[model samples]
Target: MDAAVLITIVVMTALAFDFTNGFHDTANAMATSIATGALRPRAAVALSAVLNLLGAFLSVEVAKTISGGIVDESQISPAVIFGGLAGAILWNLLTWYVGLPSSSSHALFGGLIGAAWISFGADSVHLTKIVEKILLPALAAPLIAGLVGFIATWITYRITRGVPDRLVTKGFRFGQIASASLVSLAHGTNDAQKTMGVITLTLISAGHLSPGSGPPVWVIVSAGTAIALGTYLGGWRITHTLGKGLTKLEAPQGFAAQTSAATVILTSSHLGFALSTTHVCSGGIIGAGLGGRERDVRWSVARRMAVAWVLTVPAAAVVGAIAGKAASLGTGGVIGVAVVGIAVAVGIYLASRRTPVGPAHVVDELYTPAEPTPARKVA
Candidate 1:
């Protein structure tokens, strides 16, 4: 591929991943609100989409981390970045199809690390930076969010115990509007910038920009818009899973979870951590489950989400490694990766259409359990 053409392809792929990141993690901010009837599904996503876009301009600290902190830009090429993005996008799609809200951020990190390692060797992967930035925060943020969620939930119920049910529900539902909006805003700050960083890194590798340069204004706007559009589309499958599958949420619990997750995310962004919004929000939901009056958490669902979380990095890494190896074979190899990625993406979309989940199905699905398949219908 010509240098300009390759860079264009890489930039487009990065934006595609950003689009996936938007819908895949939409549940992190709005799931609980929808579940609690705090906001209509379509309306909630619209608000989140706008906040996500505005949040992108708050700071570029996280973008700086991504562009400079993870993989050594000097040792990698545009092909490697494309491979990494391909892997991340695939993982995001697979998780969405399964109604599992896995971490898009981790998928991105894993894809990049794996592609860089497979293409250029271990030295090209920034081990110290990975530990300091990605792994450490991944381990710590969710736990902290969960703990805060638990505390907040318990307090929410305690204070509201004497209040009338109607007042409590109405009050917290109103509060969810604010809390959920903050979570969306915080999401834009951390997640939108990942794509920005990838584009910046690609520009550096292609010699269009100097090393250590920040993302340009155009890159920021484009990335922000791609993710915002995706957010508006909504990830109803994953939203249903978080809002209704993992736990039964009341308005107060929804408020607590969103507030906790948003606080943690904004703090991380300010400090330049590429935190996973999915993990933190999921943990908050779990915590709220435990703190509820009924304490009716579905451990089975929690276990399934946990399994997905654990698998995200390795699964995405494997795909990225394969894609990276293929891309190393030159133009034909890069073209091959694109073909396979497109095929798989189309397959997943077509499959999802067969039992299409959308805003129309969200609330009804909350009250209805899946029908068990007959022997003849088992896939």
Candidate 2:
């Protein structure tokens, strides 16, 4: 009922969403390294976690875009924001259970937009900014990363041709150490800022901060810590999909993919485009798969991922709208949404245990390619 209490509740929910963002997108940075044996599963996540935390402090421009650019903060309340977060978290959980590396960024944007729009109207949203910043980048970032990854991988294989296989593997595995670390850092730079923006936006809506103000020191630290902790937990299901289900990646290819993803992510962060690290990294992984002479890309797995990507925004938006409508009611509405969210979350967790894919499973799948499939052809 109180504004202060509502703001605190929304802020905590924002952090919880950040934690999901961390583990959900962990595959973007560490999947390939784990697959190629460049780092052990536990060690890879630990390294990525530390880098992600450090990266969160590197930029806040993206946060500014979220807090000020996307939606009209003056027209909405923290209740709408909480509804948006609820929708995003539910989408994130569903995708993770299915091992689909969908865009957590899009889910967040969709939820926020949907909730805000429902709470007020179209006037409450910045249509032009959403198109110019969020939508355009979402469409283009992956294609660009995929192209860069393909070219890089092709050149890597050709340049290292005729070298001893063992030597090539060893050399690139070492390179993967640096490249993957960079990707993890880039992820923190971009993704962590999304949650920061949400929290900052919540605070502003609650009249705790002025419009256009940046996230304070405490906000930044708490967000970074939440995501870092989630990264350590590891999203092995999605990691397995990227590292093993899509294609059988060589050490050199892994190095190229990570490098390409890092380049795109850091560039977008600097420009303050709210890019999806998951899309960029998935594209890079798929591109690297096709770039090799072997052409190990599995079209089926890719097709499935595409379906999930296309559905992320609209699906999350619908759920966000529903939640926002409910939350607009009052305290009882907020309690209802929380109960439903918790029930669904617990259900997904319980369902996932039936077919657990942990670090051990991912490590095992690394060396074993799916049923004898021909090169340069869909499997």
Candidate 3:
């Protein structure tokens, strides 16, 4: 393939991945608000989409980290990046299908690491930066957000004690709207930048942009638009999982969780840490559950989610490696990877239709018991 054609393919693929990233992590911003009925699902996503576009223009620091920090862009080809994106997109879809709120950020990183490692050897992958920027932040962001969420929830409840329950609920439901909006903004600042970085890296690899250059204006705008559109579409499956599967959230807890998550995500984005918004939000939800005195945090469901989180990176990496190796073979390889990717995507989509989960069904599904008891016959 011509270099220009290859770069075009890679850029398009990056945008596709960005689109997936948006819906996959939509829960990070609006799930709590949705759960608590602070905002209607469609309205919440529309608001999130607008804020996400605005937030993308807020900072390019995380974009710089992805473009230059993760891997040596000079040593890799546009094809390798395409393979990486394919891996990330496939993983995002798979997890979305299962309604597990896995980290789209980690999947992106894992794909790039695997593709780069396979294409250019170990030297191409930056171990130090990965550990410092990606791994450490992954471990700490969630815990910190969870702790803040716990404390905030506790304080919110204590302050509202002796107040009329109806008044308390109404007050916090309003508060949740603002807090959730901030999370959507923070998400744009952080998550949208990942695709910006990927596209910039592609440009650099194709020799269109100089190394060390930040994302160009076009890259920023396209990435922002793609994510915003995806956010609008709303990954109802993951949204359902994060909002209702993790815990039953009252307005106060929802307010606390969104506030804590937005704080952590914005701070991390400013620091150029590619933190997983999913991890941070999930932690916040769990913490809020614990902090609400009457609510029970379902350990069983949490454990299932935890297992998915643990496997996400390595699983995406393995698929990326395979795809990268195949794409390295030349034009035939690229065609083959594209065919397989599309097939897998279609398969997942068709399977999801068997038990469709839409906005109309999300709250009801959450309220339904996972296992219903069989009735005994009366003699």
Candidate 4:
């Protein structure tokens, strides 16, 4: 392929990944609200999509970090970036299918690292930068958010213990509306920038712009729009998992969880840490579940989500490596990889149609926890 054509391909794939990121993480903002009836499923996603677009303009700090900090752009080709994006997109779809709340951020990082490593060797990988920006945040951000959420949940319950149940529920339901919207805005600020950064990096590597350049205005608009559109589509599977699977969410816990997640994500974005909003929000939701004394936290489902989190980076990296190796063969090889990617994506979509999860089913299927095991009969 011509250099221009290749660059265009990579840029479009990056946007596709952004789309996946939006829907995959939509539950981060709207899941609890939807579960608690603070917002209807359609209204929740529509509002989240709008706020996500608005949040994109909040900061360029995370974008700058991604474009310049994580990898040596000069050492790699546009094909490498394309392969990385393919890996991330594939992982996103797979996890979405299984209703696992994995980290799209790590999937992107792993794909980039895997591709760059295969193409240029370990020297192309920025170990120090990865440690500071990606790895550390991956470990710390969630724990911090979890701890904050746990405390907030505990306090909420203790403070409201003797209060009238009706007033408490009504107050928090109203509060959830605000906090969830903020989380959506915070998500856009952090996650949308990942695509912007990738596009900017691709432009730099292609010599379309100098290294360390901010995303072009066109890049910003396109990325924001793509993510917003994806958010509107909604990721119903994961929404069910987070909203109702982990624990039965009520308005107060949902409100606390969103507030805690928003604080962590927005703070990290301002500090230029490309942390996973999915991780932070998931942890917050789990914490919220733990807060409700009568609520049962489903450890099995939580474990499944955790396992997916542990695997996302390596799994995406493996796919990225294979794609990178093929693309390195030639332009034809790049095209071949794209063909396979499209095929796999189509397959997933077709399979999804058999048992589609939509707004109509979001509440009834997800929020209704499994019935408790039958009481043991006398032996």
CA lDDT, every model vs. true structure: 0.84, 0.84, 0.82, 0.83
Predicted candidate 2 versus true structure: per-residue lDDT over 111-184, tens digit per residue = 87889889888888888877785667768877888899999999999999899999999999999999899988
The CA-based lDDT of model 2 is what?
0.84
- Candidate 1 ranges beyond 4 A from true positions: 60-62, 67-70, 126-132, 271-274, 365-379
In angstroms, give how far residue 328 of model 3 lies from its true place: 1.7
lDDT of 4 at 1: 57
Q: Per-prediction TM-score, please? A: 0.92, 0.91, 0.92, 0.91
In terms of lDDT, the poorest run of 10 residues in model 4 is 370-379
lDDT tens digits, residue span 85-130, model 3 = 8889999999998888988878877887888888888999888977
Write out the backbone clash pairs for model 4: none
Q: What's model 4's lDDT at 376?
A: 23
lDDT of 4 by residue, 1-379 (tens): 5888888888989899999999998998899999988899989999999999988877765455453456676666777788788899999999998888888878887887888888888898888977776667777866888788878988998899899989998999899999899888877877788888888878988899997688888988888898998898889888988898888887889888888898888777677664678888988888778777765688999889878888887788889988988888888988899899999999998776656677755677433323332222100
